[model samples]
Target: MIITEPKPFEDILEMLADVDEVSIIGCGRCAAASLTGGEKQVLQMADKLRAHGKTIVAEIVSDPAICYLPRSKEVIERLPKNGAVLVLACGAGAQSILEVNPELLIFPGTNSRFLGMTAQVGEYHEKCTLCGDCLLHLTGGICPLTRCPKNVLNGPCGDCVDGKCGISSSPFIKEEIDCVWALIYDRLKKIGKTEILSQTLPSRNWAAKTYKPQSIELSEEEIKQRGR
Candidate 1:
């Protein structure tokens, strides 16, 4: 799941300052799960805007999600072209809306946190970086790229002490985190798969981390075959 947090209301107000009329879009998936862009949140935001003297031209909580281009297009078509749009979803959903109509004025209502795994209701943990590479099998399912403070692939850095990672310069990982390589070693040892750690992995393909837009066109026969 993608984790998101609502942008500060003051910041939102600043973004919408120039606009007198606005349309709001919510997500029924991740944003809903995070309580950042659900129906309730959308309604609440609309009320806040109205109280602030802005006219609400449209409000919608998109089913599935606005990240789905088809749904974004559908929602965008229903909205008035005269008003600016405030998307209460992840950056992907907001971008999808822009893809549907580049001319539409779009504003993000939530700041994306990370791609995460849900621990429980209202709880999430970062698990993947979507690095476009897979080394989990060799590392016993722990992702060093995501979990390790330094993103060390081979093993813990020299600064590591005990089972904890070294302090990182990154603001996000400033606190000493548990060393993912140590966790991988312990997990592999417990399962009698320690030999897997002996082989050194090649340098990661950093280029793979960049996002590249994709398009696939299938013939009618190809599309029909996929259904089977």
Candidate 2:
């Protein structure tokens, strides 16, 4: 699951300030789970925009799995004849909409948050960092990348107060807390293999944390061969 919070209304207003007519687009898949940019949210946002004296040309429309499917074109086609769009989907969905229709002015209505798993109902936390490598089996399925505040691979530092990370002041272990490491420890202890924590882990690749646009290229010959 992907978790996201809606961007501030003030910021949204500023982003669409120049546009006279606005159309709110929503994704029914992931955004619906977080209740951010789904049908309900889009309608609410449209009403809010109307209250702000903006000419809302149409009601909100939500598509199922807009990010992975090409059906988003239908929604785009239904957008006001000549109005800006405020997309309420993940970053990928927003980008896809823009790619499909470059003429349409698109704006993001929600922040692209982390790829996470639902800890419980209505509670989602990041579980993977997509670091180009995975070491869940070695560490008992606990990803230090997302679990540890500092991305510490070795172990919790001395500053860990009651299992909470000192760096971010995040609670270490709560009464119903879902600490992946703690869960792994408990499982290992039950299996009589509690010494797994004693094993040292290799240093993490800091390069993975560096922000860089990764791209793949194909030669002209290859493109021609593939009939591109």
- Which structure among the candidates has the greatest TM-score? 1
Decoy 1 TM-score against native: 0.87
Q: What CA RMSD would candidate 1 show?
A: 2.6
**Ten-residue stretch with the least lDDT total in model 1:** 207-216
Per-residue lDDT over 35-67 for candidate 1, one digit per residue giving the tens place of the 0 to 100 score: 899999999999999999999999999886888
| Best-performing candidate as measured by lDDT | 1
Give the per-residue lDDT of model 2 (tens digit) for 52-165: 988777665556566654666676666665558888888888877776677778888999798997676578778787787798876766787777656777766566545445
What Cα-based lDDT does every candidate model obtain?
Answer: 0.86, 0.74
Report the lDDT of model 1 for residue 9. Answer: 99
